[model samples]
Target: MLSLQDYSARDALDLAGLVRSGEVTAAEVRQTALVAAASVESRLAAFTEGPFEQLPAHSSGEFAGVPFVIKDLLITAVGVCGHGGSAALADAAPAEADSTLMRRFRAAGLGLLGTTKSSEFGLSVAADQKWRGPTRNPWDPQRSPGGSSGGSAALVAAGVVPVAHANDGAGSIRIPAAHTGLVGLKPSRGRVPLGPWQQELMYGNVVEFAVTRTVRDTAYLLDLVQGNAPGEKYGAPLPAEPYRDEIADRSPRQLRIAVAAHGWDGQALSPDVRNAIELTASTLADLGHVVEEASPAVDWEGFLAALTTTWCAGTAAAVVPLLKSGTDRDLFEATTVTCAEVGQALNPVDLAVAFDQYNALSQSFGSFHAQWDLWVTPTSVGPAPAIGDFDADNPQYTAAEWVRRCVVPYPTCATSNVTGGPAITLPLAQTADGLPLGVQLSADLYREDIVLRTAAQLERALPWAGRRPVVHVTTETRQR
Candidate 1:
């Protein structure tokens, strides 16, 4: 039998190796994960559906028998409830079939144990949904684990699972991972299929992925799931080599890395976050990489306009079907309803212009990347914020205002999503009070290799494995 402490200490790859050696049976590892999840879940509130009673049978893939959970949005598994954190869909029938990504997870030997909570319609940066009470950070219970993917991040950070599903339309994956001290990579747009149901989510602005505690876990997972489904409308160029191979070398090539300590619009960051960026810049330079102070020159106003348009329009598309199905608008949060209303008012031309802005921003970032191999910035403006910081249910805010508020503090994440590039957040820095402060590393389209190599290099330079949250499975004390 694998003890809970042993299970919590090992990454997914390690556990898989253990099972392969027959030191622990697959059932024993699953039971250990379930017990660890139970130990911390009361304080973390990290699941929409807790551990499944009828777990999937073990497989013989790369990560065979590793416990995993899916987010309650975008992706689906057959017979699983995916409400996307909305009360209205609580009674909706389970999915009839597995999604493309879900299929890949099973084929790769991951045990599908449960689904985690998400923000309503994946619209908010904080997951304190009015319908489903807040999901707390493992590091600090009073603060959030960052949202839409907050539940997944919390569970992984608390040692419930080594990694869990997370998606990013506008910082959902990276924001949560950054706050919770995990590695979150938003793959190049179209690198992973949005498939059988969606051709492209939010016109390629949204991407599906996961948050993990190590770069190797992220890399290996990407290697397993990165590809196009048959007849896909869009696809990123195939990687030159397996992403896991890219990071295995550990020694990154010396390159020009751009560093930014402030928001793209020159917004102020917390002193601790700013210092972390400076320290990371120095550290990268120490590792023999050429680091300098620079950021891509972006048209801030144009970018925001496009973000507002696409995000609202996407929300409208998802929610209007339910609205027309005669589901009461009252069943939704106020922000969701208002976003649909605003989106309904827009004509096709509005979306066309928004796409145009996305093209221009991509070109501008492309030109900038021609000079710099990577762009590094603070993942969020500061450490994890309190749970109630961004109220998704507030009716007072209009659609545009809501988008602005969400992006203002965590500005860097959406840039890669809009540009169709790859970006990752590394848990390299921390606040004096011990909360993690993630730093963002991004590259031009289809250049995940650069991001991962640099991320692996940094992980070695500043190790984060010794730190554990008070609510973690390895911790004896569980705070509520």
Candidate 2:
């Protein structure tokens, strides 16, 4: 039997290749993953569900035997709890059908072990909410693993799984990915399906994708899972070629790269993040691309206010179904209830103005991209906060204060979601103190090829996949 350390050395693709060659059976791989998940569950609180009992039936896929986990947020699988980090829905009925994305994952021969925790309603950027306690960081057990998709990030970082399902609506995937030092891609809007249920989320603010250790996995998964389903209300145009093919080309492309390392609210970036951005810019220049400082000339005040309003309205809408299902409304966090109140207080005209601002930013960003092929920035304003640092249960802070506490770091994140563009985070650098520092690269709408190729270039130019976190599953010192 292979030890968990041996399994940790290989990514999902490598495991699949071993299975294909008959070197190891899928059952053996599943057992290894289950052990790792169990080993880290006490310290990391990674999965929303427990010790994956059995593998789901395999689909005809490129990665037929590899183990995987999805965040408990959006994509649903039959009999899996999709509570989405809310206490009210903790005992909700299991889903009756697999989401389109889940079907694709299974078809690719991947095994779904279970689901991971999510921020309550996918609102806060940290998993330190009232419902599921908090998803601790694998790098430092006392700190966060970034949120909404924090649980998925934690599992992937701790070597429990190579990749896991994560979705970004207001920077959920990329934020957590950055926090945990994984390759997280929030594909172009309409790139993935939101079907068998709803259309676009928050007027196209949310998108589903994954967090992985390498650019190749991100590219391959995109090729496998991206497509417009029959019922999708919106869809992005198909890529000219498969994303895998795009990243593999890696031939020197002379594109203008813009470095937008500045904070959104004019807050100064942490020393580590600042150094990482500078080093990345210089590195990109060394890679023979014209690198310079530039960012989307967005209306800071208006964008912040509008973005917050949009989220508040969406939060309100999400809770109503729970209410109709006879859930006790008082069980939710204070922030959630406050958001719903703010959302309810708004009238139609107010909502329209907010959306119109979103549209204006979208159009403006579309125009801004005409000047440069890509925009790169620090994934967060600073390092990960200690696990109970930002409290969502406190009603004392207003929404703006809440954002200031949690979101000021990842300023550039919501831009892609708002503009229908694509963005990816690479685990390229670390703080002088050894904390991971992620850098983001984003492209215009429907151009995942740009982000992937650039990320692949960065991966080669600055290799980071072998850098393991301190509190990991493979070592004897692994925390309990």
Candidate 3:
């Protein structure tokens, strides 16, 4: 019998090695992953379904024979429904064939386990679900794991899988990574293919990637999945070589690094988060990287207003089909309803204004990047809030206010989304309360190699993959 702890932290390369050395067969890996998934699914609520069989044949790619899970938002293997964490689409059928992304993942040798949970329509930052119940933080079940990639984070943090697919529109990847202590890279927009049905950019901010414990795993996946699919609207230019090479030769030239612990929109950061940022700055300075305090020039209020408008419009776009199908009655949470309504209220003029503001913010960020090679900040304003911290039922504060206060580090992440730059969150520091506190490192557009190279250096300086969540499937539990 395979140990769940050993399986959880084992990188894709290690799993491949296990298969190569005859230490474990691919079927054995599948069974072990299923066992681990079953043992933790009830307590963690990370998965939307139990163990799934009929995985594709192992490919000859680098990570061939490794078991993994995809977030329910993205289409995956046949017969899997991408409920997108909503009751309305609970019975949705699988696509006739694999999505372009899924084909690439399969080609790279990953065994599909099952779909993981995501926030309804990938909206709220909290992973708590109205239908399936909240996906608890493995660090502390009472706290939020962060969403809409919450399930992926929980499973990885809880040691269910080494890595799982995650996407970011409004900091989905980074937020959950911050909450759960993992390495999350939100690649430059258009870095990966989104195919078959959709073409032109959806919302102009969303980008998909995976969250992993090791920096090398992320770099390897990025190298594998990044390129233009046959019918992709556009593709980000490829790096000179694979990103995997960047991790091995990880020394980025001493960079001009800017540190900002507080939110760009003026929200105060918690002391623990602030200290993490300060510590990161000190570490970079010790490494001979120049560090300074800087704020990019932009109309902060206008930028945020534009983002809200665009986000609401996107929400409205998503809600229209459900409403037309008379399925709005089945929507999971009230917050989703409110956001969709806000989206519906906006007219063409509102959308145009938002687009113009986005362009302006992009230019503003470009100017800031011109001054510095990298920007370092805390991934969130505070540590992971308790599960109910962003409760939609709260009458004391409006939903918008709650989102703003809870996601104070959004500006640090939102800029990358709007500008199509690469941003990475590293689990290099921890809070006094023993919660993981992540630091955000971002670079100019298409400089993912730089961002990842820096992450590799930090990973070596302050190793974090060994730090597993307390509530994980151990050998003792597996015996049962």
Q: Which of 2 and 3 is ahead in lDDT?
A: 2
- What shift in Å separates residue 291 of candidate 2 from its native position after superposition? 0.7
Q: Comparing candidate 1 with candidate 2, which one achieves the higher lDDT?
A: 1
Task: State the lDDT of candidate 3 residue by residue for 1-480, as single tens digits.
Answer: 566767776887788888878898888888788778777777788888655876558688778778888888865556677788888788888757888888888888887887888888787788877778788888888898988899999988877778788988879999999899999999987888877666643376888889988898999988888988777775799898789888885456888988887866677877888888888888888878899998677787777777777776777788776887788555546766666777888898988998898889889889999999888987887778788766643435443554464345555777788888999999988888789988999989899988988888888777886786767767326556
lDDT value, residue 303 of candidate 1: 91
Error of 1 at 152 (Å): 0.4
Candidates in order have lDDT scores of 0.89, 0.85, 0.80
The most accurate candidate by lDDT is 1
> How much is the lDDT of residue 268 in candidate 2?
85
Error of 1 at 320 (Å): 1.2
> Model 2, range 212-307, lDDT digits (tens) per residue?
998998999889999999989879899998988877745667889999777875668988888899999999998899999987778877887788
Best-fitting candidate, measured by TM-score? 1
Once superposed on the true structure, which residue ranges of model 3 sit more than 4 Å away at CA?
Answer: 200-202, 249-251, 328-330, 392-406, 409-411, 475-480
| Model 1 Cα RMSD, 1 decimal | 1.4
Better of 1 and 3 by TM-score: 1
Candidate 2 residue 74 C-alpha distance from true site, Å: 1.7
